[model samples]
Target: MKPENAIEVRDLKKSFKVYFDKGNSLKEKAIHKKRNRYEIREVLKGISFEVKKGEAIGLIGHNGCGKSTTLKLLTKIIYPDSGSIDMCGRVSSLIELGAGFHPDMSGRENIYTNAAIFGLSKKEIDERLDDIIRFSELEEYIDNPVRTYSSGMYMRLAFSVAINVNAEILLIDEILAVGDVNFQEKCFDKLKDIKRAGTTIVIVSHSLDQVERICDRSYWIDEGEIRAEGDPISVHEAYLTAMNQSMQERLEKEDAEVMEQHKKLGQARLMPVFCSDIAERKGTFDVEFSDIKALNSIGEKKRTFHSGEAVRLRFAYKNPNHVPQANIKFSLYRDDGILVYENNYEFATGKVLDLKDEGEVNVEFPTFGYAKGTYLLNAVMYPPGGGEVFDEINNVFKITVFSEERAMGVYLLENHWEEA
Candidate 1:
């Protein structure tokens, strides 16, 4: 029987000694390691929580905000500086999936090693081997060394191994975020099955939608403290608001002129986050609400499309500078580093925003045309002089395209398939 609380943590804290002399050569650190002075970073402060048996929980916060530390501490990868964790059952952690597998080993052999580390018998693994390979969707590559496998493969096999092990507790940190859309969907279905089997799940993710969708509860961590803990929707909302505030703070400190130029751009108002690309593309929908915020609206902009249908992408960003003749450029790439498409605003717009005197411009692109694959958007600010990029967001937006009826390929030709 599962314990009442699958995992219980109290007064948890984890700290690391971060060295500041970034210029110091490796030799210096090796020589003075014992006496080296370092800055103390309290990644996780004193925190406490309990996950009832079969409860699905999420941890969200800014990067380096101690969410990873908490997950690591619970999995015993790194012991807490001070606190206690009471785990009632076996844990299958995908913290840094395949953390200690030998690259020279074939996928089959690595599965044995990974399963053994989780305390599974070789016989147990053998019985589950076919299922593991099938779940991983790498049947043909099972005999190949993991060294030859792509990063995506590593994530697939790692996740497959973790999920297959029949553990009572599962710690997942954006694990499904790695694979392709098809693989991700398969993994999600597996996760739902796991949940149905009553496995306690704890997830750490940058994706608010996933948290809200799968997690029953959520936590927002800030500077090693539990800032909020409650229902997924409420907690995620708090995290989003906190993130936007931090981004604003970072921009304020990055440059003085940035703030001044932002003030000079038309009427100064925060950009309302736009989620509906289809609706926004027609230029007929404002999709605006006084309560809709940039961080909160991020999930809406990313629409999950069926395989054969067209996708409308909407991007809303504040221009920190009031430079005229600035055009937007977008680049689309598959997760495998393949450049699918690229286009520039200079050719699309042919002119500047007349409201350049204003502090901000919220532009929408109804970019439609693509095949079944996940594509990311790379945006850049183009100035007329072309001296340097006034602003740029590298792969800021991502969308996964999948249609059940569409065949897998780079482009969908407007022609019927014919047999030779």
Candidate 2:
């Protein structure tokens, strides 16, 4: 236990004994012991990590991957079957919002009670009560019974108490996503302040963006073990790669019959990559592609298409202020970044589309005559004349074109074979 190390966990392991066919009736209960089928499920297997003072660490993994269990062990909410955790500072947990609150107590009373449990004295809690209430934004409801508070209200109060308790180590478990966007931003700002003030924080979250935003270092836990640990960006990228493969395998196993049929039809899998940095929205109005899909000749949404087949690029954009006229541009690029086709809405159709405040847009291509290769989509929106880009997507949506029925070049043109 070094002076500057807030937490150091060593060889941590936890497991549960799960039993099936435990009888409900008394007679069956008597024989249940002999008939019971039990298995040991290892939830955390020899995981070890450390958090230094003033350092923010993120734990990211799939659901049921022992992330919450590790937090519990760190907070002493649950004991590990083996291994040890060393801590040098008072800890505060935002694991379960209002977990220690007496439901009948008023929000104001719960604040004091919770803070006190976090080792705050009466004087300390009193000094911090006003700030907690102010940050929660529940001034009027602070006196109301906590049972009557909405989930959001309850979480706000809980987070307020946890953050204000002045604990040196904060264990946050995905609770910062409680409120709306404004409040979430506020919470992140507060976390930044806390980090600057030298509070060691451990956050477990599914949002990679949140992890990358707040964490200096991150650990990726998988199947009760530390799969990867390093800087947030690299850890997150590795985790995503693993998760993507896992999802593909699961999907294939679950829907083998359907996938086989598609395969037999020469259809390729569609993989979409979302690039958040490329989307540029300057003004109040915004344009971003949502639910972009490719439909086959039969109007079924698919990821792959055969040459000379009808493929429609169906997508929707958000325009809260209903910008009446915006030039829509979509470009098709080869997998290796060579531009294959580019077109503008007005240039291709000779007129602009009637803008809706929020609606779907369907662009149908009569025949997809591309070569047998993968193509990526980049959709852009510009204010009518086209100098300023309102929004642009760089090679995100993907479509695979198979050449079973058409030529091997970029264009799938129609021609007649005649004796000349």
Candidate 3:
């Protein structure tokens, strides 16, 4: 390891044996020996990186991408199959929080045991005991058996002990989600303080925003290899782009298979490419929606849009009965099921839609005035006066809005400030 580096990893590799049809009992194992076949699944493939003292680096990737495995290797919870890892100081890890905790033991007692596992001396633990208890906000329950503690309480106790260890190096793995939102914020603030105090930190997390805020650099691992490593923001942007492209390809393949199935059944079903699986369909089917799409100003299919960007919805319907007139309703909802906006074609234009055997209707929002978040969409067709329902699809499409400005609430209000 270089003198200036707090930690160094060189060509680290690890793999696990994934068994197939393995038996647990001795008798069953003996009788089905041949069924105990397994495969060597390589998780980390010759990955290498270094961190300077006081520097924080984040490992990011989709699940099963070996980032967690790498953390385990650094903490020595698991051994690497090959290569080397060198560290400079005592390490404290939030990975597998409460791993050494005894459920039957009192929370206060478990704190001493957990801190001891981090190589803290009895005197050192005694010095920090009160601080840990205070941070956990569980002083009242500190003497209670951990078995009686809620999951959040247990996590709080464990996190409190680990964070107060003041080790030279901290390894965290998705444990920042512990406790309620307020506690989570407090934990973040504590981490920032730790970083400022010059503790080398390594984090494995799916929350890219957290990584961007705390880490000096990021490594994007994929398929057992480090695909990209650099500034967190740039690395994450590349990672997201690749992931979205892969998802699009997978969705297209699945849509093709569904189309083939529909053809064989001699039925025209909504294309999976346009309709979400969670969409709910109802009504008499007098006029069924054939396809629906969220589009951009250029009429190109799009599900994600920036705040204040033009958004359009195109609805295609099949009216076998040639219903003369119908009212068209469109609704938008936030992810939390809050209705954000609702309108109808008849109400807006003062005329019901004239139906044909097959036709398309388009609704355009010159500027999509919404905050950054996901929203669901609903489309409905009914009689002019809303006596009978023709067709209604709830959550037929999902729209995602992004904004550069940081503000609160569902709608993005347009405003300007003048100094007085």
List the candidates' TM-scores in order: 0.60, 0.62, 0.85
Leading candidate by lDDT:
3
Model 3 per-residue lDDT tens digits across residues 1-420:
798899999999999999887788898788988878889999998999999999999999999999999999999989999999999998989887786899899999999999998889999999999999999999899999999999999999999999999999999999899999999999999999999999999999998899998999999999889999999999988887676666656655665675466566554454334566578888898888888888888887777777898988888988998788888899999999999999998878987788989999888899999997889999888898767788888988677776655568999899899999
- The model with the greater TM-score, 2 or 3, is 3
Question: What local distance difference test score does each model get?
Answer: 0.70, 0.80, 0.88
Q: How do the residues 256-333 of candidate 2 rate in per-residue lDDT, one tens digit apiece? A: 455455455553433222222223223323555545667888887665666668999876767776677777778888
lDDT of 2 at 202: 96
lDDT of 1 by residue, 1-420 (tens): 235899999999888988755437788778877547778887888989999999899999888888988998888888998889999888988777786689999999999999888889989999889899999989999999999999999889988888899889999887768589998888888888888899999999988788877889999888899999999887776676565455545543543443355456535533222211211221112111111112112333233343344344444434334344555566778877799888664666676544233333333333343565666656555555565655455544455554322234776656787899
Ranking by TM-score, best first?
3, 2, 1
Minimum summed lDDT over a 10-residue window in model 1 is located at: 284-293
| Candidate 1 accuracy as TM-score | 0.60
Q: Which numbered prediction scores highest in TM-score against the true structure?
A: 3
Provide the RMSD of all predictions against the true structure, rounded to 1 decimal.
13.1, 16.0, 3.6
Flag regions of model 1 displaced more than 4 Å. Answer: 1-3, 21-35, 255-420
